[model samples]
Target chain A: MSNLERIAKLSGFSKATVSRVLNHSPHVSQETRATILQIMKELDYVPNRNAISLSTGQTLQIGMITSSINEIMLPFLNGFVEVAEQHGFQTIIYTTNDDTSKERQAFEDLRQKRVDALVIISCVTSAKEVESYCKYGPIVSWQRMDNPAIGSVAMDQFKGYTLALDHLIPKGHTRIANALGRTYSINTRSRQQAYEQAMQKYNLPVLRQFYYPSTYTILDGERVMRAMLQQSEALPSAILCSNDHVAAGVLCEARRQHLRVPGDLAIVGFDDTELSHTLGITTIRNPIAAQAQNAFHLLSGPLRGIDMPQAELCFELIERTTT
Target chain B: MSNLERIAKLSGFSKATVSRVLNHSPHVSQETRATILQIMKELDYVPNRNAISLSTGQTLQIGMITSSINEIMLPFLNGFVEVAEQHGFQTIIYTTNDDTSKERQAFEDLRQKRVDALVIISCVTSAKEVESYCKYGPIVSWQRMDNPAIGSVAMDQFKGYTLALDHLIPKGHTRIANALGRTYSINTRSRQQAYEQAMQKYNLPVLRQFYYPSTYTILDGERVMRAMLQQSEALPSAILCSNDHVAAGVLCEARRQHLRVPGDLAIVGFDDTELSHTLGITTIRNPIAAQAQNAFHLLSGPLRGIDMPQAELCFELIERTTT
Candidate 1:
């Protein structure tokens, strides 16, 4: 016989009565419940969480759907998990690698009640398809979403770019260049647009030769910087990089080529990571931890029937000697 | 009514028969099974994984207990998750921050049947305590365990140190120093022993002043290097850093102080991460991905009744300009 059946037979109660006692239904009398609990302890009948979830309808899990994992995503994940663990929830990360079908499967996990809520760090899926699942559970994203029900908490990438450019232009730099990450991402697009607009504002020509599409690694920075140095055209007065790693690469390559930083080419990097601090690279401080915290609160607040205000987090610029 | 009862009513079958069909029991007639499946589809009846897990005793999930999340842990996690996903299993990571109680709770999660197997990256708990839970499920770790049931797949830290020291000694360096991460870790202890052994083998004295206990970040490297520079004793002719980040920091600080690398201070780094590639820091290639893969295969093969050999992975020395 199963543990439940054994408990029922030993306590002189039906299996349903034993289950009711296990679930704390309160319909069972105090004396009968005490006897059932005693028998359960003697039998070492530890209640399975699966059965408990079936009765309670709460998995106590929060699902996170991320496109990729890297150094940039580390702090954000750490912050989100910190808040989640405080509220007695575990975060299940599903890395989809920007595949729409895999992202849809993650949403299906939400529909199946494997998790109480879902947080989309990044995705390739349409906002409307994502919105359809909001009714099933609370959904939040780091990107801006059209649906009012879906929580949108994100950093102002455009402002981050403008801040870096503003810092450079005042230092007598007119022929400036920009090296960014994948063009497909929303953050990259925003920064690229800002770069163009800021150049237009200063009446500086936007040189096509100066643009470099770089990846997030330090080697990508070195590759792009090498290409820039090899070109016949005079190097741009300054360059804006995607992140500190890429900037560190740019600095290393420039040193290799015997080019003086700020004397020959002024460089600005984004995401004031630890590398930036070590190398004294001036960078824009992306508010990753704050954005992650906001995303979590947006997910949990609504479940408690508390209204959360939709807001965009801001970025800041940290000045160092490299600029 | 629950979806199960609704499907039964629509198919004119008993609830138990519908459940048997859902559970894929061969006792159900083929026609009846087809009809019940059709009814389930029509009603949009999605079987809950929780209920299915209770019946099948398979959660299709793997539990990972890691001490913390940092740059060092990222690749190991990526490798493990990739293999786990390919095998149709999801990995649930529990960051214990080396907290003994929290690590025990993760083990308890296994005993409660939440995960089919457990992979321990690092923990503060004793081996015997960890081994007791092996009978509950498949267990694997990056550290060596006394129990035969637990899988041990780890890199040879002693050999890694000896490789670095031997490489440096051939270059005519006697005043060599070493900087490492948390001293309490087994990896650190092993490396320290190897450093002492290699120094004695060379008939050189191990100076206490030259030993630095540094963390994983580049900033720690800078701090230790700064302290070394200010000391009354002459700086070591060469330094062996625990990892690339610290090595990178030492190089940066040396440059700031106008000390030429390999001229004033030669350096060797461990964990040939992306940073090492960018800065051309000679390092020991810690095979993290291969170790993660071995750990997963060890866990899965045993569950299939396939005996896996207990093995220790080796590290390699990457030649670069820093040395």
Candidate 2:
């Protein structure tokens, strides 16, 4: 006999009743469902997930579209995956490598019903294009969106950047150099604006010689410091980095040059990674864990009886030895 | 008209011809398939992946079951995801957190045809239990297994450990202490064995006081050093760590205590992560990227006209400032 028939015979329930329990239908009582599941477990019955997915229209899977898996993205991904697993949902990741075509393909996969929902991290595609897929499934993004139909849980990067500058400027640091990563990204633009606005508020000049454009890495951070030292203009008393890796890099290079931190060249970094805590680099806590949890909850809102338009998590300054 | 009918009308082909192209049938000529696909793209037709999966009995999705998303797993996961995406396959990740039941469920998911293949990274389940699922679909593992039915791509941890010891012992270091991570794991056991064997080969006594049991983190490294300092025994001249993070932590604590590196205390670390490079710690290269690529290829071997029983990648020693 088939596994379903065997389960029906053992549980004293009809085949249809056992099938309902397997599909997780609400029509069956909890007690009766438990009994049937126990028998199925005893029989070592493994239900076909694809068949159930087709019937219930629930894949029990969450898809995430990311630019790349690097130092900055790892923590966020880890947090997101933890939350997803706790909720009994598997995560399917599509790394687009910042390619618009790949991003579109990821959205297309969602439309094809591969996953129940999608959370996009650092998207390169336009908002309008992304918004079009909301009809297919719930779509969430790391960037804040104007449309109420889409869900977003973004960290206030502008506030975070200002928090860094605010900490440095009070220590009589007017000539603060800055490191920006990926000039085209919205996050980077907001951070740049924050630096400019904070400088203007304090009546400080935003000089070209102080600008360092490098991606997130310790090597990048070291390269920025090297470039600064080689420049003909006088070095800034303080440098604000894009992330902890860059900050750590700056600290390494500064140490090599016998520059005393906070005395000769103060450093401030974003994303309080493990590197920051280990090396004691003062940085802004990006709240990546909270963002991941909030994003997952927002995407799974309908199922969990939760309703919210958007969530803007706050970033806090973590003081350490560097500053 | 339906998507298939629309594509058929636009491409001047019958509905069955377009359907064959959509399902990726071997009967369809490449030239014909290309023409139909172009027309479907022009019309913005997205054939349902679930429907195709049902008919073809292929999900075109690879499932990975891992313990957790930590420092070591991140690189492997990223590498695997990149390779899978290049082959037009989506990756579904199941973070079991070393839970045997969850590991079983991951295999059951494979048995139920949710994925075409599965990769088990750091499994807690017994080989027999894992081998049972091979009949359902292909299952690859990170750890080396004696069973030929199961596919495996493992790095020789024994050689990796010896590589570290050989590099250190040559510099007239006899009193070498070791820090081990995850004592329960086979990899850790192999590393411990290698250390003991190397010590025996050099006619050096393996002191119990020098053995530090700590996991893979910079914090753990610092704690080990602190614990050692509090003990009555004199500190060993050189120490070996499980990974770069631990090495970095030891360095930090050593510096805090004003101990001179390579003079007062020589250090060696494994996994040559970014921390090792930035801090100039000598370490053994783990070759995580190569392991990932080889594992994926081994799992997808049947499809690519490649047949291999197993693959064992080697590790190399990288000399840095600390040694």
Candidate 3:
């Protein structure tokens, strides 16, 4: 016999009564509930929670899609998860490694399982394509992309990069180089736009040789710096890195070559992570916590067809010793 | 009329035929199915996937429990998620931050959603406590802990540390001090055992002054080294750090103080992560991909009641410029 049937037979109750007791229904009488609970323990029967949830018609689950779990992604996720938990909902994170098809597959899978909403982080999928998935549930993007169908909690990368350039320009530095890591990333593009705009405003020469590709972590930063040192005739007086990890690398390489930071080469980085603080590198503070909390609010929603708000978060320029 | 009823009326069929078409049943004729599909699109009705999944009785999903997503945890998760995706299962990771009650809540929540299994990484919960939860579904640990009910894919930290010591011992180093990151971590405890055991065997003093607490990231490593430099009467000839991040800091700090690696202070680290390679720090290779693949296999199984074999992964010491 199945567990429910056995419980029903032993408790001298119908399947529904036994199920109600198992579900902790207040409708069940005290004596019978006590007897049923005893029988459950004695039989070593753990009730089928899956069946109960399906019958109740509430999953209380939200789905998140991320490109990768790294220093950059994980902190935002932690903030997302924290807010999700506070709302009495559990988050299910799906990684796609920036593959559009894999991201679509994850979306289909989560939809099939009936997640309340989807939080997509830095996906390359078009707004029109994402709108189709909006029918499944509410979709929120981590990066701010203006889509009628999607809500986004975005940090102003343009303003952030502009602030970094402003910091270096005041320090009496010209011939500044910008290393916007990952040529294809939207973030890289946005930061690059700001860099070009800022340099053009000041009439500072933008050197193509100094622009490094695929730089993310400390290792990537070190590799880029090493390559620049080898390839370039003369290194720029100051370098604007995409993130703190790259800035840390530039600082390390400077240490190796007996060059003083801000004296020999001024460097300003994005994302004021712990590494940036340790190395005393000047960087922009990414509003990770704010983005996550706001995204959660937009996601755990009245499921679709509301005027989605555009939340453009402010960025801060944290100056210490690097610049 | 409801979506199914509207489709049936428009397609000149009964509600049962439209329901069959919706479910993709083989019994439905192709002509009728095509007709019903056309009507479904015309109606612009998004079917409730929850009802469909309930009727089908299968949800190809798994759950992973993690304390935190950091440098150590993120790589392991990437490996786990990679294998799960290959097996046509999507992973929903729950971050507990090492809180037992939070971990318990996540277990209950995932079980309710009927995840295929649970993969826990370095949880503080006891074997017996976790084994009890195994009645709901198969529970596998990411860290190797010997328990009949729980299957684990654990790296031999004792063996890993021993290998590091053996390498340094052969290099003619007697005054070898150790730095165990996280004073109370199980991995720290296990690695400490090997460190002490090796020192005892070699008739070397186990100095308390050399040991530092909570040294994980590069910043933490730098702080510990600085503290040692300030507090210690005489620095040890060699230092065995917990991980590569810590080792990198020691190397950076060594440069700061004009002390060369291996020449002034030889350093050995654990986890042959990419940062270790960049700095050329001699460290132990953590079999991240291997461990993740094995853990997933253990979790996504024909549930309980079979002899779950223990998967003890081996460790390797990578020699580099640091030591």
Candidate 4:
């Protein structure tokens, strides 16, 4: 009897179940999967990887390195996977939790696994940093670092930020604040530049006291709100949050303080996420699907050698009750 | 010059940078990585995988298949990855989106990749169906079905559902509704059965009309709430939502209709998510970290090669202002 028959005889499962176990089919109960796995371990049967790449080479697997799997990045991931797979490429995700070393490791790991390409989403890894390995295969990133080696498909970061400022400044609110996450992030820098320029244009004093840096979560927003309130500087009439979650936090905090949004303090949020609609917050919608599609076309292009363009998609400001 | 030196010279980067590019280090900038990659491609330098897998076999990589990367599952994933890496097992994730065929494909793919083991998370694959494949390698699942072949470390799912029902019925909620997600899912079935059993024990009729099957999102909760209110059947006093997101929807919808929570309609959510705390909706806390810890221990455990227990971790009912 083959390995399947031998395992079935010992485990009392049917031959088909043993076969299903070998094939990694879900049709087999978890119990059966375990029992068969135990038996396989006992038998010391290690299925190797050398042949699978050869067999499934046509699937054209692309490995995506993500910092963290969260709602904000899901659309980008979903779009990339959906579009890539539609064109016969499968996606394998490696979560590095934003660790530079782990990301570097993933770069090596994917290469060792013989993946056709690498599409990085939401990572701080610079193009120059990974330049050493980029020559081996196609690399695409959702971040824009002005890296020519990597095909870039990012939201028009600077323009997107100004759109928010443009909407807020004209409202006659000179006392404007912003929640800036990760002082080093390109997006944060872009938004910072826009905030300064817009405030300069409007001749509004830069209320640095109202600027909330390193805030990401709702609690951060709440804490920032509390901190800004305690500041020696005069209170700002408006606050621009980094994202909807933080905006929600500010709203909740404002509610706690009995301060009405727009009435007492106008607020704006980035990433018009699902919660933005339900929470009724003014936000900027990052064009995820378009960016993902553009990146996929460049990374998966048939040229195998082609000129990669800086594909910056559009963004829109959604005005809601908060502002 | 060797391939590395040749590429590095052409790209105007040091040999170390070229080696880093080939090695997939993050130290190289994206621009430099891209330039070197372009040079390598021009030189027809395709680094093969067979040798690298041979070199990196000591890394002890384990492949995990996830159904979907949503909020409820992230804790489990985080715990599992943290624990597995602690034990020196590197994880490679393959997302199948809960599609059975794709799950089976993951098994074969992982095996072909030559991973030491496979962990299946949140997939609805029955054990009996995939029994044959389990004989090939060690297979673990995050779900608890008690299939002899697979090792399951899951939340005490059935007991978890009853914990919610037990909390509600005693509060004198006879006219209770439930938001059931995926009628065929094991968790839904467990909750459905528990709902019936609890209602029967309370001597209350099973209000099937109040059961909103196939519900998942907050919008689904809103829709369910709308449907139930429109029904000629007497409106239920409270609703046990499938998850916190749905419960949030119900809460929002109730607010829309000017109905006070726990006054006109009591709401209880499962999977005490971050939103649960923010919204102050009472929810059951699924011990994801504990379950993940158990699953990791079992999957990473030296086969004791013996029988692995179906580790059922506990759940807690968190009561708040909503109830």
Candidate 5:
């Protein structure tokens, strides 16, 4: 017999009653519901939830919004999709070019389509821009500034910076430079503050010329490093980069200038991405996969009925030849 | 009156008729369609196609499948999404861990969901594995071995290698070490063939010890370079790397060993990825963004009877500091 017929026979109910129970109809009695459910359990029968939802006019679909597409965000997106798939939901991705207007439009579009939840990864958008949309559905953000109305999941940038600085300061490096990301970003600001604090704690002088603003790309890092090298000043003993991509750039520039990495300029980087392990660059590790996983859980779990959780992830300092 | 009602009144039809015309229903009469479309144009009505698609399942949606997620594929994915969006359709994404079983499962899942098209960006599966699924949708692949049953989009790896070798051979580097990717990859085999042909053209003896198989990551490049340094009886004048990521590794390891690039060991890389631009590594440039755009056009355009032109792109040679 077919699975559905077997389920009907085991439940000791008519096939019509079994079908109603499977569809979760309001017409079913409590005792009939219990009997049908017990039979389904005994027979290990699994219903096609999507088909049921379709007939009932309910869809458990979520939308994910991201700013531009590139390698830096792929891992996080992959992690989010994996978690989303496991929860029996499909994600509709909307990508904007880091434009605030485009981001707003994407939110409106997804909201109009009635996505059950939204996960945004736009670093440039302010909390106010996304506030109205949150009222329409459960909203969760990753690695951006916190919003009281929506859930947020981000790496502890300040702690990550401290870990990198802590590793460098003990190596007796007094003159240090930093290749940081854009000044406007929360992550960059946090790391910058941590860098300044670490410098003060180590009793080292902080120079304005030593801080370079980069766009988190390897080429940006290299360009900033080259500009710093051309200046009429002595090179720093070490350079602290905002991310692994930028650090790869700094390493390239240092090589071009014929400067030794650890011997001439001990370098440390953030985001201990997969590239870090391959390049042997000493870096501070931020659990990006864990961040994505937690964000998904906050937006889709049973506890979603409650307020979003504010939590910080642990980071580690990985030592390699760059330091 | 609402915009829909106004358009309906102007077109001498109900609001539903205007919507049906806006959605390009095959059932609508040509004269009635022209009248309704003209009314929509006169009213300057902009339809939310995504919302319409969500409500009515008429337009085609394509699914893009990838094995690994990284920076190299970001631009390509972005290009694909932009093209798909422009064609009044959506692109869904699925990522696998480069496992054959996982890849097969992803294909099956997408097929079961009835996506209109599939664009794969990894190793090519067996013809039999993809045959049954291809019957359900059009399948296009990128950066994999050419399969007769599926249309493919790929960079010219042999030409890319020839470009790199042409640049290096003229630079008087007779003894050149090579860092290549996995032997199983079709691109790797093509590049290896080019390397052999180039060596023969220059009458240079092939040094087996100087060749290393490394994955396309900076750390792998570094490890392979270190091993080459430790194992090779003689150092080559230059190194030809598989890609920029690996080239960055070799550059880093050479710096650690206190060997000067170009001075001690000149280098060349492939793909000319963003990392290559940052490091100023002389390499071959593949138009990944263009390839992605073409793939999207093929799946969502004429292949779907949409009004889009078909096109193909080519690769170029970019020279920088490593050579």
Candidate 6:
């Protein structure tokens, strides 16, 4: 006989009562529940997950959607896995490649597969598309989201940029340049706003040619630096980059051009990545691990009725050899 | 009634016949199958994965075990996801952190969950532990494994080291030093063998003091370089590093000490990571993507019953300004 049947027989109770005890339903009496639990332990009985899921109408699986499983997103994913495992839920990962159609398909597929919840990292979907899914189950965004239907766990990008700019402006950098990432990215927009405000506050000249729109890559940083170096006009005393990966590229290109860092030009970058430690690059340290942890908490904890949790992680400005 | 019931009623057939048709079972007749398929499309009936899994006793999931999900391992994981998705299988990642206990626990858990197969990116367990796990299911190792129980897919590390040394030795460097990774790493052993053989072939004196065993990090590389620079003895004309990240640090430290590349000291690194591309460092290019793809294929395909696929990916010597 199965463990459920044995528990029913030993306790002289119905299978439904045994199931109630196993599921911790409040309807069962405390005395009888304790007696049934004792019998279950004596028989070395283990509950069957298939039956439990069938009764509760829930699947014990969570979904994680990432733009791409590359270097830029590995640290976030590492934290996600660790937290998900502790919550006794297996994660089903879907890589959408930042394509809208693919993201929709992935969401539809995961929903069809009956995942209990979703944790989206860098969602590329529109507000309406995300809202339609929010009605179905718990959904948490690892990065900032435009839709209120999704709960977000992200760092304050505007603050991070302000810290970087504040560090540079106070260091006697009257003419400063900025290397911005893609305009479509929400984080980039926040950083761009901070750069603009900080420049205006410091009363520094903002050159149109100095502000470059590039992708979040070292090669893009190199291209922007090369463009700056080739200009016939006066060069900026310092440069502020979107992230450390791009900053590393700028440093490499500058060295290649036989320019001494902090001697020829001071530089600041966001995201104190491992490269920053090796290169001694001054940068803003975004709390990525903390953001990931908070995202996991929002995904795994009890669902709130209406208001979603919006937590902003702290940022730090690290001074190093670059600036 | 479910959508399957509607399709069966419309086709005037039993539910089993409809399910067989939907599952693409060989027992169905061609005419009836075609009619039922057309009816399914007309009715918009989708097969339930739970029912399919129950009928076929297949999970439709593959397990992946890796050392860590850092920048170095991101490309491999990306390639694995791309290939695994094509075969209609989801890849579940488990990180071992290069610990034997964690590796064993992950293997046992995956086995209990009944994953279709396993693909290990690096060795986290001893040969005996891996061999024991191989008894239950198909296990493929992306990194080289000496045991016959697991299939291996790895880049040609020995040849890569030889290529780097060949480029350097021909440049008239007699007193060459080596910056190796952790002594316990298999790749380190292979590269060290190649370096030793190359020095012997050229009849150059190999000094024990010239070799440094450090972890695979830029800071570790810098520390090793600083230690070497402080030594009273004469330094080697060139230094060969285990990986590009390490080589970048070596370059930074050399620059800090007022040394010149290809003038004061020539440098070469391995793996040709993104840092290598941005910095234009001379190194060996390993086929990381191809190796990942092959490992996924071995895990998801029919290679479980046969001996493991022991194939070596090709490597190339990329000449850059660093050398």
Best candidate, lDDT: 2
| Residues A114-192 of candidate 2: C-alpha lDDT, one tens digit per residue | 7888998878888888889999988988765545677877766888998888898898998988888876777788888
lDDT of 5 at B41: 65
Q: What would the per-residue lDDT of candidate 6 be over residues A1-323, giving only the tens digit for each residue?
A: 87788789889999999988775455789899899979977775545544565776655567788777755666778877776654435566778777675566556655664577788886678867887887677788876776777877766689888888888888888888888875677877898788788878878777667888865788888887899988888878899887888898889889888899998888888778778877899998877777777877776554322232545568999999989
By the TM-score metric, which is better: model 5 or model 6? 6
Docking verdict class for candidate 6: acceptable
Clashing pairs in 3: B144-B154
Best by TM-score: 2
**Candidate 4: tens digits of C-alpha lDDT, residues B181-237:** 767767778888898988888899888988898777777878888898899977899
lDDT of 6 at B217: 74
1 or 5, greater by TM-score = 1
TM-score, structure 3 vs. true: 0.77
Location of the lowest summed lDDT over 10 successive residues in candidate 5 chain A: A301-310
Candidate 2 CAPRI level: medium
Q: Order of all candidates by lDDT, from best down to worst?
A: 2, 1, 6, 3, 4, 5
Q: Candidate 5: which docking quality band? A: acceptable
DockQ of 1: 0.30
C-alpha DockQ for predicted model 6: 0.30
lDDT of 6 at A243: 83
Kindly indicate the candidate among 3 and 6 with the higher TM-score. Answer: 6
lDDT-best of 2 and 6: 2
Candidate 5 local lDDT, residue B7: 87
TM-scores of chain A in all candidate models: 0.81, 0.86, 0.80, 0.78, 0.80, 0.80
Best by DockQ: 2
For the predicted complex of model 2, DockQ is 0.51
**Residue B56 in candidate 2, Cα distance off native in Å:** 3.5
Candidates 2 and 4, the one with greater DockQ: 2
- Write down the worst ten-residue block by lDDT for model 3 chain B: B301-310
